[model samples]
Target: MIATRDAYGEALAKLGEENDNIVVLDADLSGSTKTSLFAKKFPERFFNMGIAEANMIGTAAGLAAAGKIPFASTFAIFAVGRAWEQVRQSVAYPKANVKIVATHSGITVGEDGGSHQSVEDIAIMRAVPNMTVIVPADGIETALAVKAAADFKGPVYVRLGRNKVPTIFDDTYKFEIGKGVMLRPGTDITFIGTGLMTAQALVAADLLQAEGISARVIHIATIKPLDEEIILAAARETGAIVTAEEHSIIGGLGGAVSELLSEKCPTKLKRVGIKDRFGLSGKGDELLKYFGLLPENLVEAAKEILAEK
Candidate 1:
């Protein structure tokens, strides 16, 4: 198991070696955000912008305009909450090649409490125009997504977790910008998951299989430009859907899937996520279980949705 932030740091360092134009800016959080690895390797290419998150974003935008691929790093709450206007006007509006790779996202930001945890980052970033939002499930996917964001031109927001999560993919796995991968296949129900929840969805599928319930698991790495085709097909074929994410049910993966399915194909759905509330200070795994974000929660949601179906 490895924290996605650790993978991001290693990937950014490797990317620095490959591309001279790749520059990194961090808001006084190089150590926590793991951009410190890049700083250690290529100090010239890295700029520690102090505690000013908004200024860091603007600087990154300027660097992007100067024909450089700038990656801005910080905590998810500060990146999306504090520097939202700069992100919207300076980066997204002009479609600058600024990659806002935020770490310590979601309730996994443990012990920092609700003020630091960013459960609503995905919702707000997803709402921004010209912003591509990604929530990679594990380290392998995080590395692939980081490379993909660096390659693609435009504003991108990649949300990463603080805690070490189970590795869900290997070298054989292929990662795309706007694609969903089906990890497990089933006919009865589908669990559409993003971020750390994807790993839990797979566990839930296994648990369900033992109980004679065939549950399909789909991992959605990209939140914006959602894989509508895959979701629609899952809804049409399975007749039931459950969305799990380390975010609010409102305007996150659950909201996106609900909107798509409601318009295109109405399917019985259940969302397993934070229920419009702030995070509490606690251990990461305990918080996940406390908020019903474990595999058992997905199992319960699946059974409920299947019963309705």
Candidate 2:
């Protein structure tokens, strides 16, 4: 197991060695955000912008305009909340090649309380017209996603967790922007998930399989340009769908899937996520359970949705 933030740091450092145009900016959280690793390797290419996330974003946009691939690092809350206007106007609006790699996202930013944990980052980032939102499930996927984001142009938002999560993908796995991968195949129900919840969905599928329920697991790393074709196919085949995420059910992965299925397919669905509430100060695992983001919660949601189907 490894933290996605750690993988991001390593990937950034490696990308630095490979690409000269790749530059990094951080909002005084080099250590926590893990951008410090890249800073250590490429001090000249890294700029520690201090606690000013807004300024950091603006600087990144400027660098991007100067024909550089600038990666801005900060916590999800500060990146999306504190520097939202700058991100919208300076980066997304102009389609700048700025990668807003925000770490310590979701309730996994445990012990920091509601102010630090950012459950709405995905939704807000996804809402941006030109922004590409990605939430990698594990370390391997995070590394691959970081590389993919660097190769791709325009504005990008990569959400990462603080705690060490189970490695869901191996070295052989491929990462693509705006694509969803089916990890497990089934027919009775479909569990579409993003971020760390994708790993949990896999576990939920296992538990359901033992009980004679064939649950399909689909991991959607990209939330903005959702894989509608795969999702619509799952809905048509399974007749029921459950979306799990370590975010609010309001406008995150759940909302995206719900909107897609409602207009296109109209499938029986249950969204397993934070119920439009602030995060509490506690351990990461405890927060997940408290917010009903556990495998058991997903399994329960699956059964409920399946019964309706």
Query: Model-by-model lDDT, in order?
Result: 0.96, 0.94
What clash pairs does model 2 have? Answer: none
Q: Could you estimate the TM-score for every candidate?
A: 0.99, 0.99
lDDT of 2 by residue, 45-122 (tens): 999998899999999999999999999999999999999999999999999999999999999899989999998888
After superposition on all CA atoms, what RMSD does each candidate show versus the true structure?
Answer: 0.5, 0.6
Give one digit per residue, the lDDT tens place, for model 1 in 38-150. Answer: 99999999999999999999999999999999999999999999999999999999999999999999998999999999999999999999999999999999999999999
**Number of backbone clashes in candidate 2:** 0
Query: In model 2, how large is the Cα lDDT of residue 9?
Result: 94
* Alpha-carbon runs more than 4 Å astray in model 2: none
Q: Cα deviation of 136 in candidate 2 (Å)?
A: 0.3
Candidate 1 wrongly placed segments (more than 4 Å): none
Check candidate 1 and list the clashing pairs.
Answer: none
